[model samples]
Target: MDNSNGMAKELAGFLIKHYTEQLHSIILSPDPRLHYPLLVDFAELLDDNPTLAHLLFSHPAEYLLVFDEAAIWAQKVIFKDLKQWDNASVKDYVHVRINVSGSPLECPETFPSIGRVRVKHRGILLTLKGTVIRSGAIKMIEGEKIYECRNCKHRFKVYPEVETRNVIPKPTICPSQSSKFCESTRFNLIEDNKICHDYQEIKIQENAQVLGVGAIPRSIPVILKDDLVDTVKAGDDVIVTGVLTAKWSPDVKDVRCDLDPVLVANYVRRMNEVKSGIDIPDDVIMKFKQFWLDFKNAPLKGRNAILRGICPQVFGLFTVKLAVALTLIGGVQHVDASGTKVRGESHLLLVGDPGTGKSQFLKFAAKLSNRSVITTGLGSTSAGLTVTAVKDGGEWMLEAGALVLADGGLCCIDEFDSMRGHDRATIHEAMEQQTISVAKAGLVTTLSTRTSVFGATNPKGQYDPDESLSVNTTLSGPLLSRFDIVLVLLDKKNPEWDAVVSSHILAEGEKENDNCNEDLKSTWPFPMLRRYIHFVKRNFRPVLSKEAENVISRYFQLQRRSATQNAARTTVRMLESLIRLAQAHARLMFRNEVTRLDAITAILCIESSMTTSAIVDSVGNALHSNFAENPDEEYAKQEMLILQKLCIIDEFPDLKSNLQ
Candidate 1:
């Protein structure tokens, strides 16, 4: 004990001297909670005296409590010692707080996994990483209290010990020895200025990928005090360093019940806006290079193979698959010199028949993306898709929804037309502005929603070749215009196509029976493709060549001039869409310059989409460049001719009356 006390005094003197020099200017700053680092090497301290190091690391609060007077004396001595050297002046009595953050190598007690935390781990320091799912309100905690005796009129202070119990300790009897203390209610309590800490509680759940499919993710509650409070929010991935402690039930009868484990955090590190932390190996890079080389040699075959690899089970929707692939690869997002952001991510919509594998494609896309959320329109709401203000611990807390949570990634909404009109309208700003603004419960803030939207829906009416495509789908023009590529899938009664599809399905079934797994596997594995996409998105930025630019401009002008009211006219957005698609095509081949071929391909895709969805005349001829402005003009002309014939018949009836 004597040796430990001597060493503690020596450490206190060193810290006081260091603080006196380091904080001479900032000692009188407004923020009194400013703490100085001791900067002592724990390894050196251990080598010199193991007991002192053990006490300092293991029982820091106890060591500070034991040598409080010695530390104060050291502080005063340093104050006088600094005055003689540098003429520094400050308050004669000021409490000096110290902090120590030792090297990770020296902290062997730091446990990595929260799953391995057990009863034996209590009171020990640990490190854990998880996603914050919930948080409570911040409150003030009293660290010390003063009580006055009612009968004897005597006052005394009590420093509360660190314990899990919620109840405050009271004096057993008055200092004057007047009478035995009956209850804590009989004494008048006093607040101590130096004994308070700001506190908040948050719940963190394990990463979803770490737990396999169908396994329930576990969560643990954590407590943050003082500077650590309000450091993290929901949907943030964080690494926390803290001490494990047990929180017992308030009721004494429930003593045998299981105690809740809570971590008192000392440090927190947030990991946000980082998508796909997968480290691509050198072999994977080599494979990607080889694949690119082959793709450059045969662009059409390579693109088709990549599209097939995206979702192999969906049969005979080549165009839809190609659009989805382009959306996944995306274009280069740019922020100009004037701070106007042009979005790179493309939006896609699929309106098809019931059994056409629309939902299947959506699920596959959601699973393939690194940070994605898949939700059905019927099960979602405006607040659920954007943000919500919930009351937690009697305080308003802003909770992020699917779009906000999927920031910088993909969001797949199935059954798109099933959503309420108001609920669906909430996504308009998110789609265009790439942001969601909330002004509820006196909290107004805008959150980033930089995510690509991929939606799927079923046709509202029966599929008839004679009917207009807009009449068959419930989506409005405004909503339809948001999607860069809108693909229409029909279950046409083609005998040859049906037979081929059936044979493919049967082949897949037979492969399953024969245990032939090669057919079911993707050419590029999902993880490898995800890593490659992330790498390209981070490293490559494609620029449009002059030839490609001219082609796109000419196509946009021609399409605008040729468009009639019935046919959807090309707009500025369509021009942007064409550029985005061309860039995406260039990126697919790992090329930095968009070629004329890429622009031609984009125009082809646009023409195919328009031809499939536009109105056709009764003679089964699609109104391409000569599309009529009014679809009802021919009917109106026929009605007028019939009226004139009836007038002529009425005139003939007068002449026929004489013959009868």
Candidate 2:
């Protein structure tokens, strides 16, 4: 014990001398951006005292207490040695921190899966990688408190202890006299000498790629203090270095019973911004390159194969599948000099009859995307879909919704027409501007919602052969116009088509049974396709060629000229959609330039949507009618016609009796 005390004092003196010599260089350095709490390498400290270094690596919490005491001792030494030269400024602002690096003694454990972490690992220093799901507000916590006794006018300091029943400890007796303290002898908190530190809490969930299908994601709470607070936001992937600690209930008699584990983070590193390629095997890469070469050599057959690989179980709807494929592989997002952003994501809407495989396709898309969320219109409200501010511990805390949570990925919404009007209106801004503005309950902020929306809905009325699509759907014109592609699937009465569909369904069922007996095989599995999409989005940025530009421009001009009155034929949004689709098509071919063929494919997709929605007739003529304009006109006309026939029958009494 005597040797330990002497070693601590010697280490304190050494640190003071080291800081004093480095102070001038730190302040005079050319680099203006220097991190506060200056980092001290552990290797240098180990050279001075090997025993202290060993203690620090083996038991960090105890070492942290010793280091903090040494820091205070060093401060006093500096103040006394430099009394004549701005001593107050150095005492107030200069902070030194120790970061253990290049030390073989302290080898951090491998990051554990969130679901696999156990209570036995508490108090151990470990590293973990996850995605931030929620973040709490930054707050100030009392590190040390000072109290002055009224009886003796003496001051004492106490370090705030965590997981203790008594938060504020009382001094045993008056310092001047060893007597029992009475009620009149009170202690008042001294504000000027108190030490406070910034603190925050965040919840991180396990990464999606590591979990199997249907597995529930698990999360852990991490407590960040001092310089580490507010370093990351929700949806960011981060690597956290921290010591796991347990929190006990204040009312519990036994401190060790039912302790809830939490982590106290020392450092956080954002991982998403760093470019780490997906872990694809070398053989897989070679096969992927050969597949692309085939696509480049034969464009038509390659495109068909790609579409088939997207969702093999669902038969037919080839155009709809192509649209979904393009949506998965998004285009390049661009921002102008003025900071205005143009979204590259393409939105799709599918409206069809029952048993049309709408929900199945949506599920398949959600599974293939790297980051995605699925919700039903009836199950989610406006606040639940966007952003909600809830009161937590007497302060407003912002919680991200599905759109905000899937910012850089996909959002799949089913039964879209069943949602309330108010609820549906909330997504209008998010759909176009790619942002959600919240001004509820004194908290006002705008959050990014850069997500591609893929929705499916059923028609309102029964399937009618002669009626237009606008009459059967419940969506408004403004909402319909936001989708880049809208495909309407009708059940046609064709025996030949029915026979083919039946045969395909039966073949799929047999194949599934056969796969149970043999090893399962898929041409393009979900994992490989997901990695391919991520690679394309990360590495490829396609530019439009002159020929492609001419083709798109001519198509837009032709559509605008042919539009009739009150017809929802084309707008500037259509031109932007065409460009996005063409770029996505170029990415599908693994090319850096949008070719004329890509432009033609984009035009064909747009034309197909327009035809299915009845925006234009068979011969390329505009249909000047919609659900939003004079919605009740058809009902009123039918009622008037029935009343006129009733009047005619009333005038002819003999005819009325004959009918009866």
* C-alpha TM-score for every candidate: 0.69, 0.72
Model 1 pairs whose backbones collide: none
Cα distance off (Å), candidate 1, residue 36:
7.9
Model 2 residue runs over 4 Å out of place are 1-60, 64-119, 126-130, 146-157, 162-193, 205-220, 246-261, 274-277, 280-287, 336-338, 463-471, 509-522, 562-569, 611-660
Q: Candidate 2 lDDT, tens digit per residue, 195-229?
A: 66777878888876668889987888788877678
Return the lDDT, model 1, position 400.
Answer: 72
Q: Pick the candidate with the highest TM-score.
A: 2
The numbered model that scores best in lDDT is 2
Please give the distance, in angstroms, between residue 460's alpha carbon in candidate 1 and its true position after superposition. Answer: 0.9
List model 1 lDDT by residue over 1-660, tens digit each.
Answer: 465567658766655644455445433334445322222344555655576657655655455444444444555555554655444444322332322234442243454556656777666545677777666778887756788878666776666443544345776766553356434335777654456767788878776556667876677888876667787876677777666777664444535655678776656767674445557788987887888687665566665556656667655466666677778778888886999898888888877777777888888888777777788898789887888888743578676777877777789999998899899888988987798888989877788888899998887877564544456666666666667887667676667767866777877767565433664553566676677776666667899998678767766776676665324325677888888888888887677899766776666556545633222221221111121234234333432332233233233344345335
